[model samples]
Target chain A: EPEVTQTPSHQVTQMGQEVILRCVPISNHLYFYWYRQILGQKVEFLVSFYNNEISEKSEIFDDQFSVERPDGSNFTLKIRSTKLEDSAMYFCASSRRTGSPLHFGNGTRLTVT
Target chain B: AQTVTQSQPEMSVQEAETVTLSCTYDTSESDYYLFWYKQPPSRQMILVIRQEAYKQQNATENRFSVNFQKAAKSFSLKISDSQLGDAAMYFCALSTGANSKLTFGKGITLSVRP
Candidate 1:
């Protein structure tokens, strides 16, 4: 089965440094999303993208966070300046349509020092 | 806004026994979707089952089944003949309206004793 793939299974960065988490969603999926989970916490939605634009975002997805599908295949999330609280497991997900069940990747563990 | 709640933080069941993880959500939209996701120690989140609000019959897959009460806004996952591998963190999620974003519960940790 085709599944979403994320790069840098684990990322370690220092505060004030910029970080980028990359993902390659299923080729045919049109809707993409980014979610995060703190240690032993529930998953929280970050943002959703469709039709080459952001459809919706959560309060946590503030100015420091940005997502881009630079190429047609690779989707990336960039953090302008990392903070200790930015440490978490970031998940990339995609679906064929709005109502379809999302397929998630193994997730990228981001750690800020 | 929609919120999902998993009241039981932890639960345990004997191998070959049965266990149910409770989930409740508050949503104003009549048309929405509910899902149960399992995350093992490997930390890979996998979809277990999904149910549409319009469906009256519960959704089932193999030994995994759901008890969905739309009126009560409850969706629970029932794992029958559970095995040791069934032990994991289970999350309840909701997606409403045209958005593909998912709102997830705090998650329930299930431990299966040998």
Candidate 2:
């Protein structure tokens, strides 16, 4: 079955640095999302993208977080400045329609020192 | 606000026996969707099963099935004839409608005993 694919399975960065996480959603999917899970915590919604723009975002998805559909198949999340608390597993997901079953990527583990 | 809760943090069952994971959600919307997802050591989230709020019939996929109680706002997952490969962290999620964002529970870890 088609699936969401994320690049850089694991990343390590220093505090105040920048990091870019990339994802290639299912080719036919129309809605895309970015979520994060801190160790031993529940998954938190970051942002949702549709029609090539952001639909909704949570407070955790603040000014530092930005998502872009750079191309027809590539969706990317960029963090302007990283902090120690930014360490977590970031998952990219896509669905044929909004709120439908979302297929998730293996996740990119971001570790900030 | 909508919240999904997985009451049990961990559970164990024999390889061939059955096990149930509990989940409860609070949502004001009448129509929504419930989902069960599994994450193994690789941490790849995989869809195990799904249930639509409007449907009364329970959803079953292979040995994985759901006990959905719409009135009580509870959705539980039952794994029958469990296999060793069933060991993983299970998350319960709720979505208000088609094409909506999902709210996930903290997840429960399940271990299948030999």
Candidate 3:
């Protein structure tokens, strides 16, 4: 089965530096999303994209955060200035349509120093 | 706001025994979906089962089943004949039709004894 794949399973970035987390959502899936889980915490939604634009976003998705499809397959989340609090495991997910269950990637562990 | 709650932080069951993990959610929207996701030590999130709010019958997949009480806003997962592979952090999540973003509860760690 096709699965969402994320690059650089582990990323370590200096504070105040820009970092882009890349993901290749499952082919043929229409909806894409980004979620993050801090250690020992619940997973939190960051953003959701559809039709090449953001459909919805959480308060955690601030001005410093941005998402782009960039291409037909690549969905990337860019943090302009990383903060130490940004450290977490980021998961990329995709679904065939609205109301469909999302399939998640193996997640990228980001550590901001 | 939609919130999912997993009261139990951890649970353990002997191999071949049964285990149930409890989850409760508060949502104003009538149309929503509940899901169970398992994250093993590898930390890969895997979908275990899903229950649609509109469905009266509980959702079941092989040894995994859900006891969904829409009125009580409760959804629980039951793993029958548990195996070592069932050891993982199980998360209960909720998503509404208006918003597809999932709100997950603090996951419960499940351990299986041989």
- RMSD of candidate 2 to the truth, in angstroms, is 1.0
Worst lDDT 10-window in candidate 3 chain B: B94-103
Score residue A13 of candidate 3 by CA lDDT.
99
> On residues B1-114, what C-alpha lDDT tens digit does candidate 1 reach at each position?
899999999999999998999999999888899999999998999999999989999999999999999999999999999999999999999988676679999999999999
Superposition error at A24 for model 3 (Å): 0.7
lDDT of 3: 0.93
Candidate 2 chain A, which ten residues in sequence have the lowest lDDT sum? A94-103
Residues A1-113 of candidate 1: C-alpha lDDT, one tens digit per residue: 99999999999999999999999999999999999999999999999999999999999999999999998999999999999999999999999987699999999999999
What range of 10 consecutive residues in model 1 chain A has the weakest lDDT sum? Answer: A93-102
Highest TM-score, which number?
1
Clashing pairs in 2: A98-B98, A98-B99, A98-B100, A99-B99, A99-B100, A100-B99
Q: What fraction of native interface contacts is shared by candidate 3?
A: 0.67
Write the candidate numbers in order of decreasing lDDT.
1, 3, 2
Model 3: CAPRI class:
medium
Q: Worst lDDT window (10 residues) for model 2 chain B?
A: B94-103
Best by DockQ: 1
What interface RMSD do all candidates show, one decimal each? 0.8, 1.7, 1.3
TM-score of every prediction relative to native: 0.99, 0.98, 0.98
